[model samples]
Target: MPRILAVDVYQVAMPLKYPWRTAYGEDHTIETILLRLETSEGIGWGESSPLPQPHYVEQWSAAAFLCLQQCLVPAVLGRSFGSPEELQQAMAFVKGNTFAKAALDLAWWDAAARAQQKPLYQLLGGTREQVPVGADFGVMDHPEELLPLVEEAVAQGFPRVKLKFRPGWDLPVVQAVRQRFPELVLHIDCNAGYTLRDAELFEQLDRFRLAMFEQPLGYDDLWEHAQLQRRVQTPVCLDESVRSLHLARQALALGSCRWINIKPGRVGGLTVAREVLQLAAEHGVPCWVGGMLESALGARHCVALGTLPGMDYPADIFPSDRFYEEDLGDPPLVLDRDTSGRPVACPLEAPGTGTEPRPDLLRRWTVNHFHAHA
Candidate 1:
């Protein structure tokens, strides 16, 4: 068991190379909460990126920071946790701040892996050396502009590509991509932008042959998604809706989705992430890891999780340079190309996530920081 002795929490805004426009809104910078846990055995790092605002999910960066500073940290600062699940249990009293709890859970897992002298993937029981990663594009100024980017991703040997789908940028854009790259594995993320009434429109999309429609309904919805899934021939993939193991089970039982996009922070952390992956696998549902534009520190955990069995689809993981001009984390992630030329990512042999925040960048980008001692 490792007893936590101190904690340092930082709220940072890492500038993006390009504005990431989604259905909800556009973000020029990714605001995230980072945790450095000092345990009896060693140090660990964790990150949870809620957008600057509450549009994507109810938890935003500032609120997640308060939840950790005022409640979550006080509950577990001096406690010894035998496992990440135990750490999660300690924070159970505070509900619905999965993003806040995730920072702690992820830190604990990183610490445990380091203490055990193993990489995070091995600790999570993943044996795969590398996993294919897909490229994702946000809403561009024009659909025609998307063609060149998609072409670049294809030229780089990416296996799949994801486009951000919104009302103004919907059918015509998808049509253009499908027409241009007829054989590319394609998908569109609605980001909870549609309702069940749009069934006719989604039905219109079946011809494009998308890999799936990700989170087409409300962020907290399940039944409506089931309705939409039943109406559309294309596979439905749930993202914002499946927040925990319980929600995952509900979605599966209702046939709400054929695929699940597992973003560790969205579902809490790696502890629940693993449970959700297992549950999805048992139900024969394909799963893939999604990114939140986190730095290499946070993305590294996602890359490690992608190697686990049942992660059938290509992940949303990207190299450091894809989003940031200069990575905020040390030893920025670089993609590897497989024999067939598909872009892939592998967990570093170093223990834990194999990356940490660069102290200078951490100091420069931090809007606020909280420190505590046990």
Candidate 2:
């Protein structure tokens, strides 16, 4: 068995190329907690970056950084684990810090994949070398600026484009996009901003033939969502609502949603994600992976997990440069369009994630760093 030899934590703040405005908040910088676990075999990296604040989940960077240093790191530092599952069992003592746990779990998988000399995707039961991807832009106040983005995405051959919408900004944006690119694969994400009364609006908007309506109501209210699902033609995709395998089971049984958007951070770790994936497959509910606008590390993990058979469509796996001006990965993920004009992301064939972090870039952006020796 390969014993854990060291753990390093880095808290980083990287600026986005353009300001990001969402229902969550308006921000220009992306804050994250990056984790690296070193074993006798090699180095593995992961990210525990929360979505701005506790609004997405209770996990935040400051608390996650603290949890990692005080509890999570100590529990798994000296343990001998050959695989991520074993490492997950070793760290089972601490509970509910899924984002914190997932960052480490991801790193362990990367390290384990390296030890086995296989790509992380292969270890995760992935099938394709290249996965089709889509882009999800943030909320725009102007709404006029929305059409061009949709037009650009269509020209670039993207299969799907998700735009964020609030109550006041909803109708026109949907109307404009539909009119401009009638054949485009479009969807709307409200980020849980409406009520049961909004069903009428969805009924009217359904004429445009959107791919889905994402999280239109409250985050945890599955019962109400089931009611809303019956009212609209567009499928309801639960993002913040479905957090675990059990929650997924409940959502399915309740008919709460026709589709689900799975983010590993929201669910805790890949173990639960895999379970949910299997569950989604069992229920015939089409699932897509949601992005937290992760840097290369988190994105790679998302890409790897998205490769599973149940991941039916294009994911929100945009190009790295879409957010960061310069990412830490040496050859940052650059997406290419397939023959059908959809973006294609080939899985890393080299050991681990197959993307190496640039030493200088890591040192430049890192605001805080700590190391623990086993």
- Give all candidates' CA lDDT scores: 0.93, 0.82
Q: Write candidate 1's Cα lDDT for 1-374 as tens digits.
A: 89999999999999999898999999999999999999999999999998899999888999999999999999998999888888899999998899999999888889889988899989988879898999999998898798999999999999999999989999999999999999999999999998888889999999999999999999999999999998889999999999888999999999999999999999999999999999998899989999899999999989888988989999999899989998987889999988898899989999998899999999999998999989
Clashes (N, CA, C under 3 Å) per candidate: 0, 1
Find the 10 residues in a row with the least total lDDT in model 2.
48-57
After superposing all C-alphas onto the true structure, candidate 1 shows an RMSD in angstroms of 0.8
Among these predictions, the greatest TM-score belongs to: 1
Q: TM-score of the candidate numbered 2? A: 0.95
Q: Each prediction's TM-score against the native?
A: 0.99, 0.95
- Measured over all alpha carbons after superposition, the RMSD of each candidate to the real structure, in angstroms, is 0.8, 1.7
Off by over 4 Å in 1: none
On lDDT, the leading prediction is 1
